[model samples]
Target: MSHTPTRLRVVRAAAALTAGAALFVGGPAGVALAAPPAVVAAATDHSLHLEGAPNARDVGGYETVDGKTVRTNTVFRTDALDKLTPADLAKLEGWNVKVVDDLRTVYERALQPDKLPAGATSNWYDVLGQAPITTALDLQSAYVAFIDAPGASEAFASVLRDIRETDGTVLYHCSAGKDRTGWTTAVLLTILGVDRATVNADYMLTNEYVDDSGSSISGSLMGGGVKQEWLDTSFATAEAKYGSFDNYVHQGLGLTDNDIAALKAKLLV
Candidate 1:
C-alpha cells in the first residue's frame, strides 16, 4: 500500500502553520507544573483490535540493556483514532489512557478528528511542521526534511516530556503509524537502551499490523513496507547532525539528561 498522497507539496507547505495550535509544553514554566510520577501496570491487551484503528499496539515489554524492561500499557502507538469502534473505546478506557498525542497536521486532523476515549485529552503535535508536510507522498524527501527540520527535535522532546509527566498511557500517532509515529518510537526505544536490532524489529511490525490492502505503491520505494532504509536514514540523519542518537535526544531535542532519567523512571522497570 502506497502511503504517499500525490498532491502539490507547496500547497500543503503553505497550510502547515495554520492547521492547529501547537501543544508543546513551554520550557522552564512547564517544569514546575509537571505531574507527579505514576507507576504503570501490565496491559490487558498488548495488541488492540479496532475497526477504525488497525495499527494500535502497546510499546512495552522490551528489555533494556541493564535487564530492566519497558513498563507495559504505559505507551501506545496507533495509526489514527478517527475510526474507533465502541468496543475499541471501551478497551482504551479500561487502560485508562490519559494523553492522546495526535502527530498529524491540522488538515489531517480536520479530515478525521480523533474519537478519543472519554476524558483522554488530545494534543496536536504536528510532526511535519518543519518539513514540506505531505501525507504519504515523497516519503524519502519528507523523511530527510523531518530529520533536518529544527522543529523535529522540539516535537520529539515535547512528547518525551509529556510521557514523563503524564500519569497514564500516552498514545501517539501519525496518519499511517509508520513514519512520524515510527520515528518517535525509535527515539524512545533508543533512549531506553534497546538494541538497534530490537528497535528495527519493533518498527517493522507496522507492516505486519497495518493492512495496506488495495493501496497503490506507485512512487513508493518499499511498496509501503516499512523499509529498512527508512530506519537507517533516521539514525544516519541523527548521526550526521548530532554525532549519535543519544546526543540527538539530549542536544538536538533540548532534553536534559535529567529529563531522560525522569522518562526512564516513569516508563521503565
Candidate 2:
C-alpha cells in the first residue's frame, strides 16, 4: 500500500481541523499540547523533559562504529525555545548549555524569538532562507535543500564547527525540531560514525516528542511528522552531487578531516 495517499489524507484532515477551529478565532491554531509527563519520563534515556520545549533531547549514548559512545549532556537538539518557562531555563542552566543555535528564518524568529537559558548565547542560521518559503510544502525538496540550497551548506557547516569549538553543550533547534534540526543531527551523527539504521531511528523519534497540530498551516503541514523517505532524500542528494556522504561532509559542507577528528574527540568517550 502506498503511504503517500495516507500521509496526504492525514495532512488534509489536520488542515481541515485547524481551519475549522480557526473560524471561531481570528487566526490559525497555536495550541500545541506537550507529550504526557509519563511518556516524557519514559524517554528520559535520551529525552529532556522541558516544560516549554518538550521536544528537547540529547543526541548521545549511541555507540559509534569504532565502539566509542557519544557523550550525553554534551549536545542537544530541541524545538523552538520561545515558550521556555523559568523552570525550564533553570534546567538548561544545570545542563550547561553554552550555545543555542536557531535554525529558523528571520520571520519565524521575529514572531517568537528563542528564550534562552541564562548565560547561553544564540546563533541565527536561516537554513532555508535561500529557497522560497513555499519549498517547505514539498518535503523532498526541502530535505534536499538542507544540503544543496545556497547558504544552507554554510549554515550547516557553521553549526558543526560551533559544536566542535564551543565550550559546554551546544543546542540547536528549528521550529518543530524535526526537519532542519533533524537533518543537522543526522549529518552530525553520520559524520561521527553512527550507522544508518540508528541515525534513522533517532530522526523518527520526533513524532514521539512534538504535537505540531497547533502550529501555523504551513508548519503543521510540513512538520506534521517525519518520514524516512524524506530523510533519505538528503543522503541521496549528497550521493548524487558529491559521490558519497563522506564527500558531502568534506566537500559539500566544507569540513576537513582534522575538523571531523576534533568533533569526534569532543563528542565521543
Candidate 3:
C-alpha cells in the first residue's frame, strides 16, 4: 500500500516555494540585478599617456582615400618634453623615437630645454625662425606671421623632410603644442590626403589631452583652450591665399611633389 500526500504537507510545500521566490526577488542578488552598470571611459588609439607629456599622440591610425593607413610610431605630436622624467625618457626610447623636432622659439627653448632620451637627437626648427611676431594679439596673428614669414617655408619644409627621412620615430612639439604645432600637423595630414574634417578634428584634440589653465599663447593673445574658430581661420586663410592645401604646400610652404611622395612612402606604409 502507498501512502497518500497530506493536505498539510502540500500546503507547507507551496508556502516554502513562495518564500524562496520572494527571497530571490528582493534580496542582495535582486539588488544587484536592479543596479545600473558601471561606466568605463573609452580608449583612444591615438593618444600616448606619458607622465610628463600631455597632448602627445600618434598622428597615425588615420585612413586615407587610397585604403592605406598612416603608420603608427612614425609621426608623433606632443607638448613640451621639458619635464620628462627618466622613466618617461625610457618609455620614448622603448618606442624607438629617435628624433625630436622642437618647434618652440629660441627663448622658449632656453626657458625649458627638452629632456631627450640618451640616443635621441633634437633639431631646433622654430616656426618663426629669426623673425618674431611683432604683436601676437591672437592665434590669427601668429598664423598670419607663419604663413607670410620669409623662413616659414623652409622651417615647415624641414619638418616634412625630417618625417620622411628619419630612420625611426619623429616626435615634434612646441611649448603647448596647440598653435604652431597644430598647424604643422594640419598641413601634414592634408598632404597625406586626409579630409579637412579629420584634419580639423585632430587639431582640436589638444584641448582634451592637455591642461590649459596656465597655458597662454604670447601672453593671453590666445589662451584658455584650443578654439575651433582658430583652426577654421587657418583653413580659410590657406584657401584664400593658395587656393588649396596642395597648392599651399608647394607655393606657401615650398614642399615639392617629390617631398610629399616621399612622406607618403615612408609614413603611409
Winner on lDDT (1 vs 2): 2
**Residue-wise C-alpha lDDT for candidate 1, range 119-205, written one tens digit per residue:** 899888786765643423466655565567647667777788888888878899876677778889999988878888777877787
lDDT for 4 (candidate 1): 18
For residues 1-269, what per-residue lDDT tens digits would candidate 3 score against the true structure? Answer: 11111211101100000112222100011111111121111122566667888777777767666666666666788877888888878878877788999876665676668999878899988666444434233455566656666676677778888887777778998777777778889888888777776777787776666554554432222233467677777777777888986688888877766777777766664
- Per-candidate TM-score against the hidden true structure: 0.79, 0.81, 0.78
Tens digit of lDDT per residue, candidate 2, span 1-269? 00011111111211110123222100122222221111111123566778888778788767777776776777889987888999888888887889999887766676568898899999988887676554545666788777778888998898998888887878999877888889999999998888887788888887776675655343342245678888899999999999999899989999887788778777766
Ranking by lDDT: 2, 1, 3
The alpha-carbon lDDT assigned to residue 191 of candidate 2 equals 85
Model 3 misplacement above 4 A: 1-44, 129-132, 215-224
Please say which candidate is ahead in TM-score: 1 or 3: 1
- Residue 211 of model 3: what lDDT? 52
Name the 10 consecutive residues with the lowest summed lDDT in model 2.
1-10
Report the lDDT of model 3 for residue 181: 77
The 10 consecutive residues of candidate 1 with the worst lDDT sum are 5-14
Top candidate, metric lDDT: 2
Q: Which stretches of candidate 2 lie above 4 Å from their native place?
A: 1-44, 215-222
